[model samples]
Target: MVKKLISVGSILIPTVLTILIVNFLFDIVPLNIQGLPLVLPFVICPIGAVLGLIGYKMNRDNLARAGMIFNIVLFLFPIAFNIIGTLSGGV
Candidate 1:
């Protein structure tokens, strides 16, 4: 039960954060402080991925696997976004 909850949270938290990050990056949501939005994802995504890993180890569930995969993608998202932005001359 507890493991499942953690697994769900690992999925939810990063998904929400990823949405916010994408919004911020694309200027859909205006944020006054430039660096503020980025800091959380770098810290949180890894934590979420780790939590998912731990949950998967404990319960052998699909939710944990999904969570981990999402977090990994989330972790790479910024780098990819930046690369694309650079190649395109500021996205």
Candidate 2:
């Protein structure tokens, strides 16, 4: 059970923390980022993509594949967030 917990955490914990950190950084950073401020919110996908690619190269196993796939999904999370927000009456 401990191993399972640790294994699950190895991937999820970093992803969640990285997401929070990225969001905080984005919010505080200036909006004058040469127009990137409009698109930088989509940065999460590349972040997860890179993590997945790294995991694929280093781990070389099912877990690595899982990481890669989840990274892509993670990348989409921002878009999903936007959609959900709009649906829920958020701006």
CA lDDT of 53 in candidate 1?
Answer: 96
Residue-level lDDT of model 1, residues 37-78, one tens digit each, is: 566777889999998999999998999999999999888877
Residue-by-residue lDDT tens digits, candidate 2, 1-86: 44333334436744764456465546654443343422443664465456556655654656646655665665565567669869
Q: What is the lDDT of residue 73 in candidate 2?
A: 60
Off by over 4 Å in 2: 1-41, 54-59
Per-model TM values vs. the true structure: 0.82, 0.46
* Model 1 poorest 10 in a row by lDDT: 33-42
Candidate 1 residue pairs in backbone clash: none
Per-candidate alpha-carbon RMSD to the true structure: 2.3, 7.7
Name the top lDDT candidate.
Answer: 1
Query: lDDT of all predictions, in order shown?
Result: 0.84, 0.54
Full-model lDDT, candidate 1: 0.84
